[model samples]
Target chain A: MKTFKLGGVHPPENKLSQSAAIEVLPLPETVTIPLSQHLGVPANPVVKKGDSVKAGQLIAKGEAFISANIHSSVSGTVQKIDDVVDTSGYRKKAIVIKVEGDIWEDGIDLSKDLVKDISLSPQEIVSRVNEKGIVGMGGATFPSHVKLMVPQGKTADVLIINGVECEPYLTSDHRLMLEKAEEMLVGIQIQMKALNVDRAIIGVENNKPDAIDHLMKLIPEYPGISVEPLKVKYPQGGEKQLIKALVNREVPSGKLPIEVGCVVHNVGTSFAVYEAVQKNKPLVERVVTVTGKGVKEPSNFVARIGTPIANLIEAAGGIPENTGKVINGGPMMGKALSDINAPVTKGTSGILLFPQAETSRKPVHNCIRCGRCASICPMGLEPYLLAVLASHKRFDDCETEKVMDCIECGSCLYICPSGRPLLDQIRVGKNETGKMIRLRNR
Target chain B: MNEITLISVISLGSLGTIAAIILYMVAQKFKVIEDPRIDIVADKLPGANCGGCGLAGCRALAEEIVKKESLEGMSCPPGGNEVMGEIAKVLGLEAKEQDPTIAVVRCSGSRENAPPKVKYEGDMTCAFAHNLFAGEGGCPKGCLSYGDCVASCDFDAMYMDHKTGLPVIKDNCVSCGACVKACPRSIIEIRKRGKKDRRIFVSCINVEKGGVARKNCQVACIGCGKCVKECKFDAITLENNLAYIDFNKCTLCRKCPPVCPTNAIHELNFPPRRQRPETKAEPAEA
Candidate 1:
């Protein structure tokens, strides 16, 4: 059971939705598809108000090299293209569509049969993935096509598929691996072919024995692919951490996995790739786990993109009367959604609701120089020092201290006995430091 | 024993004299000749070192003033015009008289104006909260009310009014502009204090559409242009569903406030208006 060499914590594995089978959520009446779901510059809207769109139609095109395209999830008439409040509580341009019926664009195979043949050339596969708007579906929502390109002079020798759904209470990836293991293997092969890699490894945490067992059984059929079960650790799903765990390769600071001749993709991303390259489907829907302590029935729903989170909550037995906070993802790294009406984008993996009593944070206490934050930081940066420097506006010092290396996994904030807001301050520091660095570069 | 003691004392005294002479020679060799006027200018400064003048500190400004040999672009905000005049007199240069300004919070989303729509429970610093969500009041551009401005004030001129959940600037603000820079939402501005320290400006910064802005805040400027149309001096400009008043052009006409439907225009330190018969009659008719 290999794990990353650096620090990690074992948060309570609140896998409440682990046993819940993935259920396809019904079509929402209207969907608000934001243009900037994936990281990087927002996609440019190609459709306008009153334009009738099919389910797989490209509504927004990723014009920038690093951006991802956006496709409509349902066949509908575009109600309006306007700024709507997103999960960040800030308004962003979104295309609101009134869903009419279950209609999909031409050429998308709406079949249940699995296609395993890798017929398309590697270059065609990459372009197809780009055209389909496939992105890393494990919360980051990075454009998958960009990752598949493999920058010049960098040779990708190995591919790592992240199946370690390490975040407590998030079982979307776990369910995907268990239910869609065969299709995911084909997806892994497609990604391997795109990167021209010979070997691929699927790293699943030991806790999900069923997923691990399921992948191991199916992996033999797909040559050059292996399943490696990792030690259960928080943040094991991080790309760098997963690479380090599976292949003993440490992605250097300020560098991508390609720097180490590796490329990591989430398990959900592999499944999405399978559908895109094989089934001719665009990345318009994903499995989102909705669970919490107060939830009546924690369940996993294969929901369409741009569906309002309120609909998902309603599917998970409705919002409890005592619900205090509803987070957009996992507890450690998720953002609290200010508006329940905010739509689920490609990145939303889970919705966690907390009771009123558990919503309030612990009272902040003075730092006792305990160095617990330093010990638990997986990036090996001193969070306490960064927090102090950031609070005092010492952004230059924060940069020198490598605040950019922080993964923001919330392990230090979780382990700190003094209840210091280490991660929050570090986030501020990282933001300021990044700005300073960008300015200096410019 | 007396002869030995005398010899030791004489040797020690000679060593001390030699060391003192060498120290004096070294000091002379590495001496920096600073103008004495810098000291006078520094003395005239309030020594707040608040960086309100965009200089490092009082000493830095003093050095700059003496080096520049003019008061051309140097004015100590905390010390105001009096200190600049004193420095100019000492330097035998004319000082430029400038209008005194004070920090005014442009947001009027008080507790009553914009009630909290969501509960914020994480870090209380406005910088952190601003990045985390829009705000408790659900206005993305309104004041966060976490007192970052209050914490940045060095003159003890700003304090958070718990009743309104807004920072109240005191008379001794000195127009240092620290609060203006401290605000994460850019809700505070340095404006010229009008006659009798009275001022009129739009208080809301929300740029959401009229209905959307009103949904989050009662006093949000809807960019209706009513105030812009009412202003005789062209002081008001409406853009992005928000209104801004140029203090330099405003003449205290007191016309825009009455015309503003949302009451987003705020008048500070002004005497109560005389009740008009039309206003009284409207209430009676209603």
Candidate 2:
């Protein structure tokens, strides 16, 4: 088994929802579909208030090249397109829809049959993926269509499917791989065709032996696709790290994975591509794992995009009495959700609730100069120094130190004995440094 | 001494003299010619180096003023108009007059006033506490009382009132705006120091709804429109579920504070009120 040849940490794998089968959550009364769900520019909403829309109907269109379309997860009338605070504690424009029916769009094949044939050309496949609003489902939510459309001169030799759900307490990808093996394989084939690549590797962590075994057994049915089991490591699922782990190629700093002749997509994203190309479904709902040590019943839910976190918590057995914080993803990279009423977006992977006892932030101490943060940073950047620079507002020094390269995996924060808020400062540094880079470019 | 020792000593001495003369020549050749008035002007300005003037330092600002040949667009906030007057005198330039200002902590949600429903066991800094979660109280926008503003104050103008668990602005505040920038919640505002330092402004910055704001703090401005309707001078306006009083229009009549149902409007530097029959003890907070 191969792993990324760099700094990594093995946090306790508290896969609480590992055994919880995916359950389809009941339709929430109201879904707050945010216009800015995906990573790039927020989608421009096309529908007006009081307009009735069907599920899978495009309400928000991707405006920029690096954007994705947003569809109403439920057939509903648009209540209003207004500002609503999200899990990140920031307010953004969202379309509030009142669910009336579960009517999907016409021509969408909402069936259980697996479609293996890829009838559409590569260009058509890329457009369909964009029209379906499929993004990197591995929490980055990068527009998949953009990733598939290789730059004019560059070429991708192989497509690596990310099945390594390396984050502790997140098994949505693992479960997706186990349950939707055939659809995922077909999805990978479709992606390979779109990328004009013949060979593909599905990288699964060895911890998910069942998923690995199932995929391995079915690999012969899908030509030019192979399953590679990886040693369990946090953030090995990262695009750069996974490309390095599977293909033995290092993506240069401040460069895309394509620079190393690879493009990666999450297992769930490949499944979505399969559905969009074959079943004609848009990216509306996904599997969300609501789990925590303090939760009454950790569970996995196939939930609509706009459902509130409170509903998922309710399904996982109402908010625990001792609940202190609810995170939108894994503990290592999840954002501490400020409002429980904030709606789920396309990138929501897991909702973890920490008890009051577990929520006490450790007291911070001056860095002992232990060099542990530098040693454990998966991005191979010095988090301690970056944090100090950020606190001093020395964004220039941070930029020189490549603070923008920090993926904010919280590895340094997790491994720091002094409880220094390394990632918090690095996150701010990345923001400031990114702004400086953009300004410099302009 | 031997002849070889004497010869070696003379050679080393000649080399040392030559090196010294060369260094002197280089130093004189590279010496920068600057206006002597820059140093005098910088000495006249406050050396607090708060960077409130948007320059790197007071010395840098002095160079800029001398280079620009005018004090037209430059001002030192800490030293106010008096220091600018002194600098202008040094530079033979007319000083610009401006109002002296002081920083005001807009939140009055103290420990006794806004009881914490959730205890936050995090670092004792507003920046750290802010990122951890909302304030201990239910209001997400209230002051966390972690003393970040006090820490950022270059001058000892702000202190955490331990009894109230809120930062108190001292009477001698320079209004350098460091605290205003340091506050993560942005609850500090630079306002024109009124005559006798008596000024009136809303004490709460909570933008939560009426019911939600009142639940978190006793002094939260719930945007009930009471202050707006009661004000005869049209100085106060309600926006984003919070009331803001424009100090320029405010007369400091002290009428809005008493009429504010939640005590959100605060009056500062006023004399002790005389006991009146109509005066009453307010409701107690948790």
Candidate 3:
């Protein structure tokens, strides 16, 4: 099995929800759909209070080239357009709607029939993906259409499909691959056509033998695609890592994967693309994994974009008695939610509820020249040195050391025996260094 | 043996004299004529090198002062008027009197006022926490209470009060503005130390909509304009669902605090209020 060359770690798999089928969560009472769900500038809201909207209706329009359109996940009456607390615990502009009935917009084909034919031209497909607001559903909600439109002078010769759901306890992608293999394969072919690529590879970690087996069996039917099982690594699902693992191409520092003639998309994104292109569906719902040691029933639910996290917890057998913290995503790179009522966005992959004993961080100790952090950093940067410099506010040194190259995989922090807050300080340094570079460029 | 020793001493002495002559000539050729007053001015400074004067250090500030030959746009925050007066005396220039100032935390989102909605884990620095989420109190603009400001203080003028979960500035604070810069949310402000060390200003910085801000913090300034209307000195301005009081224009009338519906206006070091007969009579009527 192939893996990224530089550095990686093996965390506990903790795939508790792997057996749970994706259940369709009932519509929430009120869905607070935030406008800024994806990377880049937030979409401008088009509807106001007292306006009636149907499911799959365009509620906000993405004006910027890099943004994604926002659609209503449920048919409802717009209660108000105001700032509501989001997954980040910060107030952001969102459209609050009161659930009325299950009314979907026209032109949407709501059926279970599989359409294996690709009808639209490549250009038309890209615009159609953008119109549907299909973003990468593997925790980084980057607009998929932007990825499809290869930049000038960059030729994409291969499309890499990331099926390595490496984050512990996150099985949304795994379950999606197992259940919707045909749809995802079709989506992969659609993406390959859109990117003008002749070959595509689906990279899955070796731990998920079933997913690899399923995808391998289906790839022969879908020409120009294959499955490559990879060594189980923490961040194998990262774009660069997955590319390096499958195609032996390392995306250069501070550059996108397309620079290496590759475009990476998540399995969930491929399924979403299939739904959007074949069934005329917009991206409104996603599979979210709700799992933890303390959870009564670790399950995966196909939840709407604006469903409150509290509702998901209730469906997964209410909050555990000893639930200490509720993280919005996976354990390695997720943020703890300050408000349980904060609505889900496109980027949310899993909701992990840790017990109180595991929630508290270990006591920090002085560095004893262990070099474990540097040894385990997936980006091959010195995490301990960067953390020290960041704590001391030496941003110039941090920038010179290539702080921007950090993928924030938390492997360094995970491997550190002294329990140093390596990733936290590195994040601060990256933010400050990025700001300094931007100011200098301006 | 005596003759050899004599020859060795004479040769060594001559080489030393020649080397000394060359060194003296080189020094004279590349001499830097520095003004003597720079040293004197630097000596008069507090030597904290806190960079509160917007310069590199005391030495840089001294060089600037002596080079400009005027203290018009230069002032050392750590070394207040006394040190400046001493430097002025040494330079034979008149000293400018400047108002004394101190660091004041603007947010009143204490533990009791705005309790933590969620527990925070990971690095405790406010900078990291600020980048991660709004805050434990769910106020994006409120104080995070992680004490980055306290950690940045060089003079031990700040400490985090556990009861209030806010950094308390001491009297020794020279208004050096280190805490002001250390705050990620810009919750600490350098305000004028008023007469008898009394000051009045709004203690909340939340700019969310009135209902939203109040839901997170009980003492958030809702931009109700009550303080703006009550201020006779035109000191308060309401904008962006928050109220700000201009310290320069404030006359310490103490009228705005009573009219504030949320008690967001904080009066510091002021005398206790006298009991009003109307409040006592209300209970009797009831």
The interface root-mean-square deviation of each model, in the order shown, is 0.9, 4.0, 1.0
Give per-candidate clash totals.
0, 0, 0
Q: Tens digit of lDDT per residue, candidate 2, span B1-286?
A: 9999999999999999999999999999999877888888888878989998888889999999999989887878888898998888877889878778889989888887798865655345677667666777756788888898998888898899998888999987888889998888899999989878989999988876676678768778878777798889999999988899998999988777777777777888899667523423244222
Q: How does chain B score by TM in each prediction? A: 0.88, 0.84, 0.88
Against the native complex, each candidate's DockQ, computed on alpha carbons, is 0.69, 0.22, 0.75
Q: Candidate 2: misplaced stretches above 4 Å?
A: A361-366, A436-442, B1-32, B109-141, B162-165, B204-218, B222-243, B272-286
What's the lDDT for residue A79 in model 2? 98
Q: What is the TM-score of each candidate against the true structure?
A: 0.95, 0.88, 0.94
Model 2, residue B28: distance off in Å is 9.8
- Residue pairs with clashing backbones, model 3: none
Which regions in candidate 3 have their CA more than 4 angstroms from the true location?
B1-24, B92-94, B276-286
Kindly list the per-residue Cα lDDT of model 3 for residues A1-442, writing each as its tens digit: 6999888899899999999999999999999999999999999999999999999999999999999999999999999998888987788899999989989999999897889999999999999999999998898899999999999998999999999999999999999999999999999999999999989999888888988888888878989999998899888888998888898888999999999999999999999999999998999999999999999999999999899999999999999999899999999988888888999889889999999888987788888779988887888899999999999999999999999999999998898888889999999999999999999999
For residues B222-259, could you state the per-residue lDDT of candidate 3 as single tens digits? 77787898889889999998889999999998888887
What is the TM-score ranking, best to worst? 1, 3, 2
Q: Write the per-residue lDDT of candidate 2 for residues A302-399, one digit (tens) a residue.
A: 99999999999999999988888888999988877767998989999999999888886777888999998898888889999998998777999998
lDDT of 3: 0.91
State which candidate, 1 or 3, has the greater DockQ. Answer: 3
